[model samples]
Target chain A: MKKKWLIGVLLMVLVMSVSGCKKDDQVVLNVYNWGDYIDESIFDTFEEETGIKVNYETYATNEEMYTKIKNGGSNYDIAIPSDYMIEKMIKEDMLEPLNMDSIPNFANIDDQFKDLAFDPQNKYSIPYFWGTVGIIYNTDLIEEEIDSWDALWNPKYAGMFTMVDSQRDSIMVALKKLGYSMNTKSVAELEEAKALLIEQKPLVLAYVGDNVKDMLISGEAAMAVVWSGEASTVIQEYDNFKYALPKEGSNKWFDNIVIPKGSEHVAEAHQFIDFLCRGDIGFLNADYVGYATCNTETMELLDPALMGTTYAYPDKALLENFEVFLDPGDFISEYDRVWTEIKAN
Target chain B: MLKKLSSGPYWLWSFIFIVVPIMLIIAFSFSVPGEAFKFSLDNYKRFMEPVYLKVLARSVKIAVEATLICLAVGYPMAMILARMHLKYRTIAVMLLVVPMWMNFLLRTYAWMTILNKNGILNHILSFFGLPQMTFLYSEGAVLLGMVYNFLPFMVLPIYTVLTKMDNSLIEAAEDLGANRRTVFRKVTFPLSLPGVLSGVSMVFMPAVSTFVISDLLYGGQYMLVGNLIQQQFLVVNDWHFGSAISMLLMVMILITMSIMNRLGQDGVEQGGGNIW
Candidate 1:
């Protein structure tokens, strides 16, 4: 009699637990993005309005994201990779073509961001944030107006400046100062760039990565080669610092979101992407992350103070002089060797 | 047989985590990437370049310097701690270990705060009317980071050996009319050689292969072999080259360990069962 009663209780518990799980299980969309790239509050709002769940994860660099996706260990519904990585993924068929009918807010994207060199047809990726490389200077230390890349090579600023310790960005600066294309593949052009960098090495206080902000804001270095977003972010905190677009031109890079091939919830992913594209939503994210939004509608929604800043949104004429970094393909080895030689010095 | 069967989980864990990964690395080291997993020597050939050789030599030099500094500092502290009363010995060991409980990166970054040009160290120096110093982002800073972080590893092992040492040996040497210096040189030092060897190896391995310490404290100006491997794998997307470097590093470490082991064995033979 006792055993029969225990069996009845067990069955009741199992049925109740199953029903509980069914009620709480919502459409889950997995998102992979750059570390600290988005406004996290947006996720909470989306979950409340749409009754969907978000599984958000972040990677430090594009190469790390590519390796994880290629391994197929995780089922990520959406991934945000940089321009060159998006090109590589599209070429390798690791991404799914977007269904535009589901994303009507796609119209908000500026025409300049459309038909990009990485995804010319706009079939695979959506532009998220775009920015150009420029020099950030400390005004208190330098009385002169900084307008050109040559300021970095000034002997007077020796041992008082930092350069971005990235192979492409650093090499691009040298190439541009010499009046050559930032994407030059010629051996002589690259060698000249490497020699120029070696000449300027003594003047550099350090070759740093993301720590350039702290180094500059604290007056440890008089100048740094930094991205436009970092300049805007630091400008809000320190008034002594200012950003400049060099007359010699620089690399304009973009980060975009795309769906990897192995995702399970494609429709849910589309909904999330569309939700992010709303004008207000885009403005909140751009303001929070301090990056230039590619959304034309978002620009209209932004305050005049934000729209007026050239660091946040540079003039169109200056952008025309910028070049995007292309995938170097097999010649990437040459770039690697050149960078190693410089660091080894 | 039943007791041996209980160790199955450990064997499985080792095979999955250690043995398999090592095999994969060795296989990848010999092949060209983007092709079949067939054999090729090109990857290894690339590491024979003068640039890579220089990086490897510098890594060894830094590791050795850090290890030697740890030994010089740790030996005296360990000895004093071992000689302390039971209550105080516990407190001393705890103090040495407390810094390690915090994240290593946090500790290294703290050094950055103290050593930067306008940092706390300079502030104190300038307050005294002394010249401000550029101490951060230099080789000395990197060495300081390595020694500060790895000092505990060097201390604990020697402390353990000193504590376990038989007290009668020192008394025996004393009764034979040997002075204090002679007792330590002949009795204490030889018996403690095993701990010293292990401690040296422990500190040397991590110091030799560290990229973060140099990258942060020296500002990426000093690229060790570990940084070279990291650059190839993550930035250059050349897994073949990275694997080759890993294999070379492993062989170099293996040779180092064997030499150290031989020295330890010689100490044991010379001590003639003096160590417990």
Candidate 2:
């Protein structure tokens, strides 16, 4: 009996070793992206069209995606990170320069998104989705014209409003209200922003993340500071809701897809990127996610109702005032310190 | 030799998964960010600031409150379960274990739905002509989350100890003409002290180190030591300071467990009996 049991165990070990060394007849592309950012059916369509299996994973934030890739434990062929993080990764020599020739669909992207600060010359990244941070307020509860950041601080709306809990976004709101750059390195300016946040804490119903959309939809709060894409979705569901871009302006952000330095399947990654840039695919994703697509071809295909929406296509006058958050470089620690103080207090 | 060989897999597993990770954490705790690993004390020094200290103090305060609340609620329930007949006790224990089978995140999400301003709790209150209660993002909400999640940890250990307790001691106290209250205080409570200590440690350890409960229930406004460490590592990418905070939290928990162990030993001696 003992000999038979030992033979069974040895057979199992041999089988496992054999399976581990099986020959790869098909290409596999590992893609990591933000959670709920893509339409799920796109994966199946891509796999079927290209005959390449996709190993898809998701992260909640750009920083989280960076840490996983930087640690070198997991290798993903493609990652979607925001502009500031993409800048940080490029500086750290953690991204590979894209071979633009392989991505002919790159021509479909709007020229306005090209040659941006994070990856000037489009050397290492392609813009995925671009949106602005704004306020979503209930028309029923809010009687005034909500066009400025000052509405968030009004004591009349005390305990009736929510703000995004992200460190950069939350701090950016205060900085814009104070007539300071969101990326200001001046300690005095940052201290002023920090104090404004501390004062606003009592009036904030909660400092939430994506739950701002939920809070607004459920009528739990009179107003919520939210992203343009999420705000558009909430507006569709609730007729009483309206999204406004404060006249002082807000952070205009872009998320882009790029290949990390050590990714093994560069060719397949390029194929995946080019496929996503197709006008139909881009339109499908943009419409499904309620976000603005960077592909100019996709823009023409978008529904007229969506094109007319202010959140997705803000006025040119309003657009002129938006600022993208720059890479803070060594000053990031200072911002983190201020954020920690705000939360701890 | 055969027995030693039989335990070889366990030793290797612990060495690889447990010992190696801890060694790396200690190495990271003393290293500087954005530099090659080397011995430095900057990470620990950074934590000495009053801002970080206040976070630590608040974490300890809230954890202590949750642990005490657990003991107050759990001890009586455990005692009642222990004293019940076999069939009824089994049904009661089953009811307690049912919630544990669900994922903890799902359970926390349920609380979120119930406590929000337009949630079921407030909806019911307003239906009865009462005012709405906004309790979603408060310290009380955080405490509620901790207690709801960790109460089972407090109950199971005490219940096991009480079930295994010797009945002869109680009979002896009764035969000596002692009343029910005297018997409970003199015999049962003293003998159960070890269980109480273990339960407190179990509850306190997780309560003090949790980030998700507070982040979700309190709307990410409040910062605990756990949240501080998480933000350092994940958000700010400052693993050095995160590692140092982790080490400090580990040492703090170790000291607390040692004190509880000493008390348990004293309880054993005073009761003139040994707990399994």
lDDT of 2 by residue, B50-140 (tens): 9999999999999999999999999999999988999899999998999999999889989999999889999899999999888889999
Tell me how far the alpha carbon of residue A308 in candidate 2 is from the true structure, in angstroms, after superposition. 4.2
Candidate 1, residue B27: Cα displacement in angstroms equals 0.7
- Tens digit per residue, CA lDDT, model 2, A287-308: 8898888999999998777775
Index of the highest-DockQ prediction: 2
Question: Model 2 off-target regions past 4 Å?
Answer: A1-21, B270-276
Docking class of 1: medium
lDDT of each: 0.89, 0.90
Question: What is the DockQ score of candidate 2, to 2 decimals?
Answer: 0.87
Give the worst 10-residue stretch by lDDT in candidate 1 chain A: A301-310
DockQ of candidate model 1: 0.67
Q: What is the number of backbone collisions in each predicted candidate, taken in the order shown? A: 0, 0
Cα lDDT tens digits, model 1, A261-345, are 9999899999988988889899889989999999998999887687656588887777667898887777888888888888887
DockQ each: 0.67, 0.87
Residue pairs with colliding backbones in model 2 are: none
Cα error, candidate 1, residue B198 (Å): 0.6
